[model samples]
Target chain A: MSLELIRDILVATVPLLLIFPTLFAFTTWLERKALARIQNRIGPNKVGVPLTRYGGRFSLFGLGQPMADGIKMLFKENIVPRDADRLFHLLAPILALIPAMLVLCFLPIDFPWINNIQDSVKAFMLDGAVIFFFAITGLNTLAVFMAGWASRNKYSLLGGMRAIAQMVSYEIPLVLSAVIVVMMVGSLNAAEIANAQAGWNWFIFTPWGLAAFIIFFIAALAETNRSPFDLPEAESEIIAGYFTEYSGFKFALFFLGEYIAMFAISGLAVTLFLGGGAGPGVAALPWLSVIWFLVKIFALIAVMIWLRGTLPRLRVDQLMGFAWKFLLPLSILNIFIAGSALHLLAGGRLAGLDEKQPILRQLMEGANPLVVAGLWIGALLILYVAANGLNQLSRAKVRPREYKYAE
Target chain B: MSEQIAFWILSAIAVLGALVAVRKRNLIHGVFALMIFFAALSGLFLLLLAEFIAAVQILVYIGAVGILLLFAIMLTERVAGDDGRRMTSRGWFWGLVVAAAVFVVLLLPAIQQWPTPEVTQAPDPSVEELGHKLMNPYVMTLEVLALLLTAALIGAVTAAQGMRKPKEEGSPE
Candidate 1:
């Protein structure tokens, strides 16, 4: 309602709106270049060639490829499959784009651009950002399923099913890893988490932090349906997968949504793990921290591209197995470890750790060490046994005779 | 005023979508409508100062649930049956009466006794505070949720395995 509060909301949201589209564009370019390099072929090298005395040069192997792709997609004919429910087919892409775009609202690119200027403005500001992030990110799965179903193709249907299964499976680990970070920092606001890691002792230094980082990275990969986990769009198996029937701008929306989602995930990971926008001893130049955050995000994105180039697509069963059998248990353990360590450190019971005045910390520390150790060991044993049991169960269920081809 | 206008438009779209979801014979339309409903709900959540919940609502319901429903519908049936007729039988009068009764029941309290706003508290329920609460006093709840999720995973895998096709005894004729 107040001018100052309105200014802050505008400032926070404006940059996000501008930055996300630009980032999405950059990701598309990066993916193409990376994929091309991996395939041992020249890619998109003919665009944006300036006519110089040197007879023009292909710039960055056509870094403007995304622009070209975008233009081409826009002009292409929008085809609705004859058998498709036309109304839903038309709606699905828009539905997908909206949720993907909404995620940016919760992301804290920098400190709240506006302090407490007006009470009304404060209401709009996202304080519990991590929860918002997870909630928004979870919506992408629904968008994907909608696309597949709207296509009315068997391949699309299968792709949708695979995507839903994979996403739901990985979401557990994704959330759990986030919980670990929350456990360590005691806050879910992305900006606050970054602030907490202001100094050298970023959460990444802790044992649980490392585990969380790995879990989050893997889950992000799976969540985005990038290669090694891209069964949803496995070209060889399911053709174009969910978006098989889409063409033109509708198809482009899906494509843009994917890149944007990837960027968002990378931003989230950087925020939670790599001290988002927080630089080393550069607190004076707060803007440089933003650069640091972007650099970290870029590095993460490059790693994802590398993953796409290197790893083969996972079989659906294997993907599910990895999520349920490995990542879930690991995430749970990581949370426990993080919680206990924080408790110990706060109480000063652990040597070289601080003794906090908090009674909760004291209680946790005062508890029997042997009991804690036993519980930890017991958890590990149970996980191991459960994993083995699951493997056995899956093997028994497969029953080799069932898969035999009946000619 | 503009924000309110946007909210009304989005809310209307969402309601329309939900209606279409239930009324349309085409399963795919229903899924799309559900997505619209989610998007609209998310918009509503945003209006309510529950941005986190809004985002999650869209992400999970629109992105995941809508997509899953779409897939299920597509896989189970062909598109030829996608008439604009109702998929389920309509009990219009009874349905309206029931819906109206529920709405009144929910709204009557607010209408009769307007609630007083509480004093603004310090250290507002920010994301950080939520995290601290979750890890500290509510640590046991977090642990329990984790356990519940693990059990669910085990159960899902077991059920999937159980539904696997029976082994073929010999080659088909």
Candidate 2:
């Protein structure tokens, strides 16, 4: 290949390879610190930065913790079960880490506000990026299964089974919710989806979009196997689930994969629901868009950590039922609602909206407040009724029995 | 030149994967081989510059269908050591005969006379253009396909529920 071509390839890939792992490392520290604060304790306060004046005093509030964790993981002994499938055991972590990192390459870090500037921040751009993202992320389940089954342990097998079931169940809603945004935006390109929400036209501001976002966020939580939906790796129940047999760097790889996947899905949520990289003054200063993007991602990550600190892990049956019986139907209905609303209000178009025009513009344009509000209210009403109806259906079939506690 | 080489490589992978998928003893291995086959076909689609179809090929086939295949294989009791369950060597012979007849009648001619328009390069349709074609001209076909899939799903669910009822009735109370 030519030198210029090689340079271009590096320019695209190098940042992705570097940034995601670094982000994962820092996110671990952030999660620990946040969880600690939530639980009323100081976390990771003993590791200090080298050569700093207050290095020993405050320990830089444990800024060096992730580095310390990395070193410890590297030096830890690699253990393999005697009866384990050694080849698959070796392959699983690599399988897990690679796809999570690949998802990061599609997410645009910032849209260029300045004219005539090279907008090469995103590593790869595909016409069907949304599909690409889900397709790549779906590979994570294979890794989980490999790790679980290869271990040859019952707990690991159960964990892997739960992981597969959870992933398959949640993926439907996750894709459906994303499909709603795709329907509204009329494009599967991630950048175009983000740009459609320019100047505070974020999907989260709309009622139907808000419902889709909530569904997407919930599914994303299960997708990453976070708390409440973390039945796969529930420590108390399944002995750390699929990664039970892993140790040393392999164990660290699972954590790295998990955190990076968390960030990727959150980045997707930002791109789909929130106006990705679109903030006040982002137009005047293009670099600030990057900051806005990071802020949104970190904020979402913080909520995840908060959830980890707050909620109890859900039962496997409950988790699967919630995904299949609730989230999936809700999301499907959401797609129908969003599609009809878009066709009605904007004449099946998200773009071409005159920002200056009032919500109820000219009748001929079909972009009016009455149509928009009616659609939103109609969607919300349908959602409420559907949820209530489903709740009654389940409740009617299986009534909750009162438990008698030992006195 | 590079695209041709890539196409050849992908075709090799797809063919080899299909071979392994058919020949593998272990059901899980066979399922994974099938996944590789589907994935390679997706790569071939990408090579042909059908990005939408390529992504959908991966998304639907590898992501959903492959996982379902894996789930079925994993959940079933017939993972290994089920040689006697087969219908016998005569069945394989008949299957080969049917497959050969189909290949001769349908596949061989399609491969030999595959059409390409008189153009240097094929037009690369954007996602918008692809959507327009599907929604406008091919709407009936698309709806029919969708309805067929939905009916198949319902049939599967009904069959599963039917099997459960007989088992429940046959069990001692």
Candidate 3:
């Protein structure tokens, strides 16, 4: 509408647009290097610095690889199957990219230039931003389905179905775990949640919060179709999954979309569990909060890459059973544990701590150390017992060796 | 002016999506078109400053209902769909008549002013307020709805498992 409003919108969003794609390129390089090192090899070493002669002497740890790969992908031929649905084939990558990019706006990463803008852009200001994040994230399944169905390949179709099933199942635990944070914070605002956990008061420090964070991260991995839950794109079984028929820039778009989704979900995890932008000296220099936030995001992303390198993809039934039987029930029980813990700790009238004190300080001061320790031990033991019982109940009666023979 | 532009654009998209959803011969295409309509409807809700409703609208209708429709279609018929299939029915006239009647009935309140209760203080529309309302005054209704949904879910699961259990138990090789 107005020039100021337009400028403010750009100031808020353009940073996200630029930062994430750049991070994605870096992540691609990072993932290759990390995974390579894990498997005992050098990765992308030959792709030296651009605009330099091919001596490979002035290399940047093969940092130029993503750039070279981008160029190659750009020049590659865009292929479409003869019998595929042309419209959906064209639309699928675009659809996949939309929700991923959109959710980035909801992350509470306060850039320095943000001070210049007013409240014209309400992306981060929405009251239901957390819920909005989950809602938009759900739309990716349709894109996966679209890509799968549009390809008209049986394997692609199977990939799409598996993706939809996996995403839908994992989303329950994802949202349920997030519910613990929302319940504790008493607001769904991203910024509010972050501010609520200012300095060392991250939700992850508490027992139930720790359980929730683990559940949330695992579910987030599945939601993003990352390794260990990448049944949708299992190469050995269903080719490349939903993107089997995709090539060139369309394939690149899907890759970018998936990575951005990874960043958005991880950013959310940071905002909710890890103290978002909450670091030492952040109060002294407000601009450092953005750096802190990015550091936290990278920390989570590094863990995701680590998990990817370390684990094998799960079987379909095992995946579903873990989500529904294990994570789902565990996360639900986790909420009860969180609520009661909050009541006894924070919400109880007996507590005489000052209102302005941090949660941990209040928790320690309000109750005796012995009582708090006892409560923590009690909660952990309950969780251990519950998790063990759920595992026993959900495990198939037939052993894995017998299962393979039967198959 | 911005709001007006957005409203018109969103409304156009919604109408176009609904028409495409109803008229498409392919079930998957129709379901996706329906999702587009739902997305547009959520945009409209956002425009009305009902963020919670807008989020829930997309979350439930497009995410849950749309996927359910796709699964049902995959189960019941060919996904690629028959090209020569008719998009209209023999009773299409009556269907149109009924749809129009319902639409007009729904639009009547908008066309004509109606007496409504007025409070001195406008209620807060923030999510916090909504939660408070739900947990306090409307908790009974909310719990009842939850109960109903839970029953339906359990009933559906039992019905699905019912068809398989007898076959597994009674069959002898």
Top candidate, metric DockQ: 3
Across residues B20-86, which tens digit of lDDT does each residue of candidate 1 receive? 8777665655666676688788888776656556766866676556655665565567644545555
- Cα deviation at B56, candidate 1, in Å, is 6.4
Ranked by TM-score from best down, the candidates are 3, 2, 1
State the TM-score, rounded to 2 decimals, of chain A in model 1: 0.82
* Descending-DockQ candidate ranking: 3, 2, 1
- Each model's lDDT: 0.72, 0.82, 0.89
Enumerate the candidates' DockQ scores in order: 0.45, 0.58, 0.82
Q: Return the clash pairs for model 2, or none.
A: A360-A369
True contacts kept of 2: 0.67
lDDT by residue for model 3 over B46-132, one digit each (tens)? 878788999999999988999989998998787666767765789999999999999999999776766665445634559988898
* Interface RMSD (Å), every candidate: 3.5, 1.5, 0.5
Error of 1 at A275 (Å): 0.5
What alpha-carbon RMSD in Å does predicted model 1 have with respect to the real structure?
A: 6.5
TM values, all candidates: 0.76, 0.87, 0.93
Better of 1 and 2 by lDDT: 2
Better of 1 and 3 by DockQ: 3
Interface RMSD of 1: 3.5
Candidate 2 C-alpha lDDT tens digits along A324-364: 78888888888887666655765635356653232222222
Per-structure clash totals for the candidates = 21, 1, 0
